[model samples]
Target: MRYIAIDVGSTFLKAGQLDVQNLAITHMESIRMPEPLPNENPLRKEWNAIQLLELMKGLIDRQLASCPGCKGIWITTQMHGFIITDEYGVADTPYISWQDERGLEYADKLGTSYFSALMDRVGEKAWRRTGLWEKPGVAAVGLFHMLQQADLGLEIKRERQGKACAASMNDIQTLDSKRLCTLGGYLIQSLTGSHVCHITNAAPTGLVDVRAGKWDKDIVSAVGCQALQFPRIVVGIDSVGHYHSRWGGVPVYPDIGDHQASVLGSLADAKNEAIVNMGTAGWISRVSDAYRIGEWELRPYFEGRYLPTITKLPGGRNMAVLVRFIADVGQSIYGITLTEDTLWERLLAEADSFSQKFLAGERQAGKGQLHVHVGFYGGQTGTDSGAIDCINGDNLQVGGLFAAAMEEIAAIYERNLYVLATAGEAIRRITFSGGVMMKNAFLRDAIAKAVGIEAVMAPERDEVFLGLLRLALVSEGLYASVEETREVLLQKLHANNKGA
Candidate 1:
């Protein structure tokens, strides 16, 4: 059997054909995500909902054309953003992305930010129920911002007028509805004609009672969003409906969160292993058999499992900051333009050389090294500032800078492991995935050495799609359980390697 796996990622929209019998991806394709729409408030990151839907459909059509015998479609997407839609799933507003920070803006006479006001009204219990950390970009925060604008009545009018003016030039819609869902849910509704989302995606919205496996009525009432329509929650294996395309009607599963999907795809042993994924952002997650709350964000995992995760750690995006800085200096001072790829090549080489020297006792740790904190973006503790300290004559260069940054990133992971430990998670090994870990061997080594554990790379390159494929298998009844499926697939992989 075959299934089509789609990942509506922040950076790219990816699709692949999963050959279930062989346990391998036969074909794959991707395109860059649509650029964010221009807004008067630069902090507001929005996308053309209809445009994104059309682009995703086009990508699926291309995939279906390549694999005509595909049995079903499974999707996973970037978490924590949403679009308002009507009963029929037609978008009423632009897609508010996770990068949107409108909630940070002051909202009232008391000068309380929208996020603060929402959290204040809802109280701390909402966070415990949702198993999510309070963030400005969460769907609840965005919805509260919209509700406040509508209640105040002036900003919504201005926004409506602006959208009306732009509607003639572009096909954008104005904000006019109360129903909201993630981009993945919107796609599933458009495809299968069902309005639903998986718990993995809904839990991040700060409205779901993750422990109860349903929407929290108290949170909905407290947020003053009782009029809003929320998607019905489903499990990973639940089929929403069928998508009737020209090729054929295929079973469409409910959309899941990309973070959960990537962890699932990592194929790490959930009992004693943890996963460290670094993409645009970074997170370290470990599976728990029961619901447990701690300093970390807890998310619903497949098979009634819960993942205690430390999210929003600096990763590839943070490294990009340093790369851009070096490139900017090169262009401005040396009158030469340097590409990011060239800069990364040089940086990785230098970092590797430094690691070799340190291991050989030629270079001493902390003697002349820079103390770099790569938290260019704020972390979970609300620490928005990052610093580089102990800078002296010996480590001010680009190579040493990147090396120090890598060390700091690794150290952050090491420090945060204690949070999981406090929550009673005993991690014996770490499975690493994401572009940063895949490309930078020195970073991987640094993290392994720091964590004092055996480290292994994720078996597959496209962990999101691989995860979706696993879900598809279970959903189709090919396997009795996720654990059984993993064991069988691992056995197949082992046998393939032995035969080779």
Candidate 2:
């Protein structure tokens, strides 16, 4: 069987056809992700959900032109972002960026003292009931009200042990009867005409009961969202709808979060591996079968496990900033527009020389320093503050500044890894992915040195799309389950990579 995989990302949209039997991508193409308004303040970070849906349809149609035998279509999208839909499943507003800062204001108004007190009262219970910690950034709570806000009505129901529990009413009335949906849910509705949420995408919303795999009514009430405001939950491999394409009917599987999909597509042994994907944003995720939640935020993964991850908001964006800074400085001083690639090459050369000198004990620490820090979304330690402190001289060149930034990024990754390690999580190896490490060998080695682990590149260049392929195989009955698909794919990759 063959499948078409769509990966809707913040900066790029990728679609491809994969031959399941041979584990080969028949054809793949990527384009810049469409944004509605490039200059608008809040909307700048957002994409038009309807426009994206149409773009996806076009991409799939184009791919079908070459590979008409595709069996299914699976989607994996950027997480923590969402779109608003109407009662009839029509998009009501533009898709909102998860990086929006509205939630910060809301949290600040609540204050640390007040918020901490509230967390002390309901945090543990919320975690137990909803599988989410009470944090502003963990869930896209910062952008939750972009759709609608209303109080929820609850009904009493009995569990298996005949214990009374608060059940959400089926009919949740919003201020205008509109509802919230993730990018995946909205796309699913547009493609298959069904309103549903994949467990992987739902977990990041901070509204899902991670254990029960459903929306927690108490958490919904806390968000002022009625029951129906959240989409119906579906597992990763379930067939959500059938997309009718020109080739034929392709079974569409529920969309999974990009992080979860990357793990499924990249990790050979997820249980003992950590994944670090540095794209527009960066994250370090470690998977475990047990439902463990500690300092790091726990997200639901395929195969009924959990992913404890630390997200870096200004991930690869930091590198972009450095590239521009280097270009500007070079053009003003030397009258040349240097590309990022050139800057990176020079930076690596400078770093190599600096390392040699430092090893020879000839260079001092305080002088000629390039301090680069990328600020965090929330007040996360080691990343909450950013600065590039250096003197205006030969030392303030591209190589030193870029090397310092990479070191800071690696330092942050090391800290996140320590948090997971100290919590008793065993990490055997770290899998690296995303655009930041695409052709940069120096950054990869730097991250390995900082984390004190061998950082191996993911088998597939595009892990999210491969993850969608895994779901497509399961949805079309080519594979019995997600676990089976994962094992088989791993075996195929091992066999293929033996010669390399």
Candidate 3:
């Protein structure tokens, strides 16, 4: 059977048809996700929840029309964010992007009291219960929603061209009886008319009892959110309902998060392997059999598995921002427009020379003099901040900046491994995926070197879709679980290769 897999990503909504028997993508299409409102706060990245849901439906329709044999539908989406829905299943608030930073500002303002008291009481309890920390980005909206209900004068402010704009807080009070779901949950509700979310998305929200796959009532009580406001939790194999599409009604499964789905899609060894997905925001994940909370997040993966993930900043997009800055600076300084390729080549050459010099002990990487700290979310914190930290772009040429960023990313990989090792999980191998390393072999080599392991490139570029396809198959009773489906598909692929 064939299945339609939709990935509701941060920047794009990707849909594809997967041939289950052959384990290949037959067709694929990508649609750009709607941009944040210009009038919204410059720091805030958000989208109209209802509008995006409609666009997703349109894309699903296109996929169904193109793939005549589509039998099932499965979806994956960006993990973090809050989508508030009223009793009529209409969105009551804009979807808050995980990149939004207003929560950090709130945390900073609350200072000692926030971390010591509120975070310890509310956040820690939730973390212990759900295996999810109150990460500034992940749980910010949920916390804000709760705080606003208390009438604590907490305001969500937006600025448009320096003019102050305010998001309506009137919706906060009414949410007591309303429903709140993630982007995936809301979209699934629109598609299958099911007010439910899968464990992959639910566990990371600091709102669910991850081990039990249900909302933690204690947390809801502590956070002052109504237990009924949250959507019911379901696993990947659970079929919520049927989506009435161009191909008629198909069994639709609960939507999962893109990160976990990517891990599944990459076909990483659940026991002994790690996955590094490099993109606009990069992350390293290692799957474990059971819940094990630690400094890093223990996220719920498919089939009751847990993933301990360490996030990385300075991903491809961050590197691109620095590259653009260097190009712009070079053009203004010398009346010569330097292309990204040219700059990258020059930077690589210089970085190689720098590496040789360090090996020979002829020079040392300066400490405290320059440190390019990528943001918490792996995207660019500022245009020139990353480049500026590595070199003085005005006075010193852009030689080691790119190298510094690459090294920092590798260091982050190593650091995360160290944390896992400290937690008593020793990973044996790593499988890497992402568009950034599709061309840049140097960065891949650097990561391999830093992690002290050979970074294996995932064979499938459409691993995310493959993961969703597995979910669809499992839902259809073709496989017992995602892991079993992956193993059986691998066996088929191996046998086919042998025959060929």
- Give the candidate number with the greatest TM-score: 1
Per-prediction TM-score: 0.93, 0.83, 0.84
Q: What is the per-residue lDDT of model 1 for residues 48-132, given as tens digits with 9 covering 90 to 100?
A: 8888888889888888898777788888899889887776787777888888888998977537998888888888876688898
List ranges where model 2 is wrong by over 4 Å. 36-44, 106-124, 127-177, 227-229, 332-335, 357-370, 376-381, 390-395, 423-425, 475-491, 494-500
RMSD of 2: 7.8
Task: Give Cα-based local distance difference scores for all models.
Answer: 0.80, 0.68, 0.69
lDDT winner, 1 or 2: 1
User: When superposed on Cα atoms, how far off is each prediction in RMSD?
Assistant: 3.3, 7.8, 4.8
Give one digit per residue, the lDDT tens place, for model 3 in 130-155: 66555555643455544643475555
Name model 1 segments beyond 4 Å from true.
156-178, 358-368, 379-384, 495-500
1 against 2, candidate with superior TM-score: 1
For candidate 3, the 10 contiguous residues with the lowest summed lDDT are: 378-387
